[model samples]
Target: MSQDYSSRGSVSRIDASISVPVRTFIFSSLLWLLVASVLSLIVALKLQVPSFLGECPWFTYGRIETLQRNAFIYGWASNALFALNLWIMSSLARFELKSSWLPVLGGIVWNLTLTYGLIQVLLGQLNGFALLEMPKEVAPAMVVAFLFAALWPAVAFARRPTGNVFVSQWYIIGATFVFPVITVVAQLMLLWCPTLGVMQALVHSWFYQNLILLWLGGSALSAVYYFVAKESGRTISAYYLATVGFWTLFLFASWTGPATLLGGPIPVWLQSVGVVAALLMLVPTVITAVNIFGTLAPRNGIAQAWNNTTLRFVLVGAISFTLSALLNIVFSTRSLNALVRFTPFGQAQEHLAIYSFVSMVIFGAAYYILPRLTGSFWPSAKLVHLHFWSCAAGSLLFVVAGLTQGWAAHGRTDFAVSALPGLLAASLLLVGHFAFALNALGMLAADKAPSNRRSY
Candidate 1:
């Protein structure tokens, strides 16, 4: 007899099978988020007041910045994405996950390795590359741990009961396959073998761009597609365009890496090609934005749409994703790039894409996923609102300040005036991080309180 796990009522079963691993990932991610936020605050403060932590070697700006980036990417982003991807794939496949212990074990190893790697970074053993700072010795273990964590989900996707795979599944699967290859290859080339001269810069630049676009960007898009479709209860508009958009991103995004290296030692022709690729990225961006926005349009009413906190966050993130793409395209242009290349505009753009777009969408996904997994609603709408508003406001403040500083620094030689805006931006970001941590803690506490009360 064929095992039938595709019943519409199998959500509980799916949740049950995946809950342990999912919760593990989420809880660990939140904890890391708090740690990363503290690191970020320190990095921000150092920018404004260089002597604030100057006495400590571990607290130096370079080490702290590297630690913060690694923490956010590996600690927060990796765990959350794994959780989201697992849930999305399982739900779409209409099958309970098999061998859940694999992921749980994988998660334990992943976190342990991450902790060790982070400590190494703090001890000034950094690889001196953006997003690739995790030590080479630990790199292979991370890859192994990730594969361990990701294996079950990939198997579930392959053994999907449903033949009709959705766009979300496509993106998640693509990301799952792509991330490990990119990570291992990048580490080997840049960290282990050590590429020659400018080649190292090129590889580093390529790795960073691909990490953001293929892994983070792909995962964020998957969350957006899944949540927007589920919450809106609407079919994606121009569904065929999603295929086009996905292919466009997969094919062209790698080429956009050289755009960051414009005016560097790389060939002018390569930079020009990157510029074209970056500009062409707008195609997929527009396609995705239009498709998702159309699905998210008020099918019932505006008030109803606004009432859904998850949808609201996803909407904001979707908009930011589009805006980020546009900004990237504009900045890739020689004239605009020449103006903003040395300024805080680059940081502003990174914040917009990573935190505003990617993290916000993941937050929305978590909001939707957590309640179902725990069989409970969020503890407090007030806290949710606080988290949302603070993040939104702080991101806006941070981006605006960065842009302002970028514009101001264009002509001036002294950076004193420009640094003021960065200080303000950092303060706003700290407040936002506090709000996020508090909201997460409140949710966890609330989730646990009912059980404790029952026992008492």
Candidate 2:
């Protein structure tokens, strides 16, 4: 057993050796996140006052919305996921990352492509689909860049020292493999070949759902499993159930696309299948919640768990995920769907899942991982607290106000007044983003002196 452990020195080397690439990814991600936040603020303000940015054609709602989504998903989320998953894969596989230069080059290319794509979007060259709005010219470059970026992690997983794989490894590997395939397929069908009229909508919907569930959600869950287990100092509870949850998510989640088109021209059977899939999502959600919540529950006492910042963020994210799942199930129902389908409810649900849940989990993982990667402690606990509260408060305000807007807009045509509060609430999130940016920059700039740091 000791020999088995000794053979894993490469994994330790990974932690010590990959600091430069990891910091590059993280720093780039935060910079993009700040950019996304500014775009989001603009969009929110535009919602309240349509004329706010109407003077410039590039700043029109449609173009800004597309740019905002691209920046958030590709710029912020994808970059952060690359850094986190690279570390997670190396840690789990007990191997050092090979060909590290590939990811660094890939990171540069990815950011450049995203910058070009957003510029094109602002210039009105959008593909006109929800998430696929990035110009098709950049798609091939993105695919190549992603392949390069993901190569090291893929190699590390393949060369894992042990047959035993952790739950986090499963999620990280699954997402890593799945994202590129779906992305290429979506690009071909929707952008390259151009699916027939209504089929285009279907294809776009399918891709969007798959991207959210299989990619973003998978990576976030990986972080959740890893951080929760590490911080709690416990192996996952009901381990087999986690496997079941993973498989269920992969199998059923993609079929949920048609539910988004309940009132559209899609076939009844397809919508029925989507609704069924949405409802079936409860299986994985419940299983995941049970396993994670059980492991996070008090062992000796609750104080340790309560005091842990990572655990607190993960727990809140888990709860948000579970609630989002329940709300998806509820809103997919025919009666409820009819009421909220055309309103801000869907946006509320999206913000809850992506911003509140996935982003929170990533933030927690950053809090834990950054210190180790940077060889320094976070500069200020106060900033961390400020970030947490601001995010929580802002999310609560946005969701509540969005729900209120949706309720008020249920049967009405003019709902601008109803959306005012949500717009105001969304502006508060800028404060949280600023707090995070300041904290991150301070940590990066602070001396890496051992004397100034607490032991991780």
Candidate 3:
């Protein structure tokens, strides 16, 4: 009897059987996050010690902030999702890559864009809007890189038998296919083929929201659904219900970003709709989170056994998925929104979404991916533990400090350290940065070689 795991529509096995390219993508993403994390800290430090790295034009706060965002979002988060989607497609279709070269090319282009984009940002020509900071030149490159990158999985899934679609597959495969399409269209319309006076502000808002919710956020959720459901060892009781969640989310959350940019000059209707849609988004996010966590409820049993690095990282991601969504909703509120619009609080929200929610999921995927690709477990479990703790602790501290200090700045609280000391907010951020740096070092040092194969 060929113990047919696929027959039952199970993808649990794929976690243990990823290829080298898939694994490399995972590692590279972590590396990006790890490095970007350091830049974030340095940027924070520059806040307090304005003259610490004085006149080193390249190391200015402005430059480092942009670099940190680029590395974390595009370099780290995007790469991780790209790699995991490849693995998911391969498993769903039961097919090996026809040519890994395409993926390699994709990765090259993606990294090149990140490198070039950072250089431009450091040189101070970045567009510099909250969440839309990547310059137009770099944005177009991202479109090309992402399109090329999305192809591998498109091929992988295309080859699969239609009957094999699992709930996880829908989100994973569908998201991979959807992202390139949405991003490509958004980039073209918003950047390349601009139509003058055609609700430019509205279009811009839609593009930003979709890039995040439709492309990045959707991709992030797709992986969470897969890993969480799989890790839970339960076949998400209601696949159809999930489709309901997806489409509803697509329709509602898709239009809310422009609204989030409320108080700006967009039409009243657009902003109003955004506020409503943002709240409505809670429906999907909450439903999905409840279902996933419910499936994984008695989390101790099977999860305890696979206390592997990959599982732990993903678990954090899964939990964060819900938390970040909740945070987005809070920030989405006009009452709270006004306070955090341009403050570090907005940065905190992005980091939580990208770092804790998205990156954590990718980290989990890497943990599961590396052992198979390299034909070895991570060199050290302890090292992985260190990486895990450092990242977790650092992110928690950063978000908490940023939000609190941001409010202090906004409120102009006389008692708030920031009111008395000009450096108070920045100083809090610097402390968080120091913690972030320690975590990054932990990530770099986490890799280990097999002990017995000293000469290999």
Candidate 4:
């Protein structure tokens, strides 16, 4: 939040202790982000020109698209969370991280496992379930590595020196504990011990929804809660709502997944339950909006929000999160579902939730955390600006195009014509991701440069 950002100091011994491991995870995440961006562009192009990579089976739209999503989720997003959340947890708990090598080693193994799974996916060895496309063989390794990376944070939370726990810590630790359980359930039911009929779909939907809303969404909210307070120099505006919001999000978001299976092979009762739960999502969403935006109101003016790089990204993300929640409720209704189901509307919703809301928050957190970890400011403010605008424009374009495509489908418009905007959006995202990667790498390099070095 300070203009002299280069002088930002580490908050605790834990931050200094975990610097190397956190940097390892972040660097790996950047590489995977580049990979995902390239794949995204390819997949977007192939949607328009099916024969774009005609001769190569591995580059087929299905494979490339799946790989892109997996790389973004497991490779990019998960790694970033591991780095950011672990640090956030330790700092909040005022506990030093022990066995830093554990996270470093875990990050290495996790990425390697992801690499193997992605290769297998390209080789047509996918498990065929959405978001759980990675082959069953990789599941054990992924879980083990996740545990290794997650251990210190759990220890820090449990052994905190102080009795006072922050809202961010509550959300972070909740997400950390929930993910492995949901993931293991998904793996066991979908892959290891296959379920019968639509139960498979039910399980996958449940897992996917929880992964997005609980794990990814929860983590992003944690960052929002911390940074909003940090940057605004105030406690959260609606501090009392924080507890209710936390519990409701976890309680209701889990049941909302079955709404995705509306009018599918699932039973009507279950689908109805999901609809009710999805509508109920408004409870937490409204609370979050009030808490974040209320705290986000600037004492100066609009210019202040725009000038603060982290606040800019976080504000966009907070707005997107609220929008996503509303859209999800709309889509959950049977009338709207019938209109847009099987079209690109669902994908558009996912894009808004993940890229616009979750990834934007992650980017904002990275901008703040990397400087502290590396003891150097971002080397290029222009690149930071570039990254923000490109991603913002791209996410908007993609979401608009996707929703337009869905509506067009209902209007009997040509699919080919409808997809053109998506191609353009993907191209912009590729550029944004490159800028982000370069900027991050530059910061990392600056950390080691003789002139930038300083004692922690």
Please state the error at residue 248 of candidate 2 in Å: 0.5
What does candidate 2's lDDT look like per residue over 1-456, in tens digits? 121223321223556555556766788899998998889888888877889978889899989888888899988888988888888777777666555677889989989998998999989898778878888988889889988876566677789888977888888888888888888988999988987878887888888888888888998999999988887888888988999999999888889999988888977898999999999999999999888887877564235765888877777788889888889999999998998887888888988888888888888888877776656668889989988888888878778877878877775545677777677666777788788888887876663322333223
For all predicted structures, in order, the TM-scores are 0.92, 0.93, 0.82, 0.95
lDDT of 1 by residue, 1-456 (tens): 132333422226677678778888888888888787778777766766779889889888888888888888889988999999998888788667667888989999999999999899888888778988877888789889999886565787889876787898888888888888888888988988888888888888788888898889998999998888787778888898999999898888888989998899988998999999999998899899878877766555335556888888888888889988899998999998988897888988988898889888988888887766665557667778877887787778768767776877776544555666556655665666666666666666556522321111
Q: What are the RMSD figures for all models against the true structure? A: 3.9, 3.8, 5.6, 2.4
Task: Please write out the lDDT profile of model 4 over residues 306-366, one tens digit for every residue.
Answer: 6788878888898899999999998889998888788887898899999899889889889
lDDT of 3 by residue, 1-456 (tens): 122343321223333333445645655675676677567656666655668677778777777777877687777778878887777666667765645666667777888877877777777766634444666777666667777676666676667756566555566655666565665665566667765664656766676667666667677677767766655556665556787788777787777867557778767777778888988889888778766665666646336624755667776776777887788887788887887787767767766777677766766766554444333334455556666776677667667667566867666543234322223333443343344334433433443322222121
Query: Candidate 1 regions off by >4 Å?
Result: 1-11, 298-303, 411-417, 445-456
TM-score of 2: 0.93
The lDDT per prediction is: 0.80, 0.81, 0.64, 0.85
Residue 451 in candidate 2 has what lDDT? Answer: 36
Q: 332 in model 1: Cα distance from truth in Å? A: 0.7
Highest lDDT against the true fold, candidate: 4
Distance from true position, residue 317, model 3, in Å? 1.7
Q: Single out the weakest 10-residue window by summed lDDT for candidate 1.
A: 447-456
Whose TM-score is higher: candidate 1's or candidate 3's?
1
Q: Give me the candidate number with maximum TM-score.
A: 4
Cα lDDT of candidate 4 equals 0.85
Supply candidate 3's per-residue lDDT for 350: 66
